[model samples]
Target: MDDPIYDIELEDCPICRGAGLIQDEQGWSVSVACMDCGAETAHAEYRTPEERLEAARRVALLWNMGKVVHTGMSD
Candidate 1:
């Protein structure tokens, strides 16, 4: 679980370089955390309750059939 955030960042994810996923050793496959903000190729940090709610709303809209599809999604 993530704590609420305030500041929103548009920076590249250092972990995935804003790719929103990590690739396999052979680069044949990739997977997303499906929880982190950067999974959308953009990230938001909600430090406050309001911001957290906003983030949650955004997350809710990302679901397809109640399942998150984060891999290969980029801005």
Candidate 2:
């Protein structure tokens, strides 16, 4: 049987805290990719509304720049 997707915790962007973007005191910022988590997305993929919203927020903040993490289920 396939394991639960959000078991324990979802593979979300750590840097952006699932928001997907980060800013510095110097008025500079950048977006990150959930690419680090390939297992979750590669195998049993699931997209909850809250998750999508979080992903969207991160992408939005990037304005289509940088990698917006593609996190997935993993250890």
Candidate 3:
């Protein structure tokens, strides 16, 4: 299956400059997380396919804007 979230461009981790990943929980919500420092954006919940895409986009935007929560490392 091709998830549209994968099509969205994401910025590197604000804390570690590592790769970012789009993660979903049980197909209901999405968030962007850093692969190295574990920084993440707030979860965007969705109820439909359109919402899912929008949620993905929202998180990606937040990530690119450097609005992320770093829980693994000190800033």
Alpha-carbon TM-score of each model against the true structure: 0.29, 0.24, 0.92
**Model 3 segments beyond 4 Å from truth?**
73-75
Over the stretch 1-75, how does candidate 1's per-residue lDDT look in tens digits? Answer: 343321222233434443223212122222223344434322334555565556544543333123343454474
- How far off is residue 25 in model 3, in Å? 0.9
Q: What's the lDDT for residue 52 in model 1?
A: 53
Write the residue-wise lDDT of candidate 3 on 1-75 in tens digits. 877789999888877889999999898999999988889999999999999999999999999999999888666
Q: What is the lDDT of candidate 3?
A: 0.92
Worst window of 10 by summed lDDT in candidate 2: 37-46
* Runs with alpha carbons beyond 4 Å of true place in candidate 1: 1-44, 65-67, 70-75
Q: How far is candidate 1 from the true structure (C-alpha RMSD, Å)?
A: 13.4
Top lDDT prediction, candidate number: 3
- Report clash pairs, candidate 2: 32-67, 33-67, 33-69, 34-69, 34-70, 35-70, 40-72, 40-73
The residue ranges of model 2 lying beyond 4 angstroms of the native Cα positions read 1-46, 64-75
Instruction: Report every candidate's CA lDDT.
Output: 0.36, 0.34, 0.92
